[model samples]
Target: MFEQIDCPEAQRLVEAGAQLVDVRGPDEFARGALPGAQNIPVQVMAQQAGQLEEHKPVVLYCASGARSTQAQMLLQQLGFPEVYNLGSIQKYYTC
Candidate 1:
């Protein structure tokens, strides 16, 4: 598994225009999410990847880093060069 990321680091990437995707379930995301982050749920990442914007830097996140990291790796295996896991949503979702 990948090391966890801090809120500050995640926020910096977001500020730099990373395409943040929330992989948490809909309920969790509905409660809160990083500003501008979209909820796609990790369970659907593989199938829904085509829906992602290819030109942007993709940053995935969940309640914890695990699912996002997994999603990131999956995307990478699928040839997504700009994918990364942004870690815990609680660490960054303030909006």
Candidate 2:
């Protein structure tokens, strides 16, 4: 199972050049997203994932923990190194 990183740790990774991915639908992403995050909706992640650099660290988050968790494992299987799940988007606002 993939471990979820705390918001502070996730923030550090983002600052250090990790790819910030929002795995929610366009509508949700449009409403709000973490700073520097790019929407890559979980439904089409496999196809759109090529946009990301395989060598870069990836930090994923969704409305809830579910979608990001799924995306984290999928990205790992697809050969992306250093995938970090930040769980819910709320954590970013609260932590």
Candidate 3:
């Protein structure tokens, strides 16, 4: 899938108050993630859709790009206006 946002851009977004979501399992997220990110597995995002709001954009990531891509699509389908993929968890390391 086409990338909606790159790691650097995503980092900037995070710094600028954009919402960050770690779409990995809790154990993986507990290991580490971008600061201020919310941990919510992709498999449970649909049921937890209430936790998100459409007006504010959300930047999501996982161990790889795949799960975040799925999350972006699901969020969009759930009517989120702006959903961005921040790529893999590695991106958080250098940012």
Off by over 4 Å in 3: none
TM-score, candidate number 3: 0.89
In candidate 2, which residue pairs get closer than 3 Å at backbone N, Cα or C atoms, i.e. clash? none
Per-residue lDDT tens digits for candidate 3, residues 1-95, read 44857768887777887889999999998888777889879999999978876688799999978998999999988988878897787876764
TM-score of each: 0.82, 0.97, 0.89
As for TM-score, the candidate ahead, 2 or 3, is 2
Go through the candidates in order and give the C-alpha RMSD of each one to the true structure.
2.6, 0.8, 1.5
Score each candidate by Cα lDDT: 0.79, 0.94, 0.84
Q: TM-score winner among the candidates? A: 2
lDDT assessment of candidate 2: 0.94
Global CA lDDT computed for model 1: 0.79
Q: What root-mean-square deviation over C-alphas does model 3 reach? A: 1.5
Model 1, residue 24: what's the lDDT?
A: 88
Weakest ten-residue segment in model 3 by summed lDDT:
1-10
lDDT of 3 at 86: 77
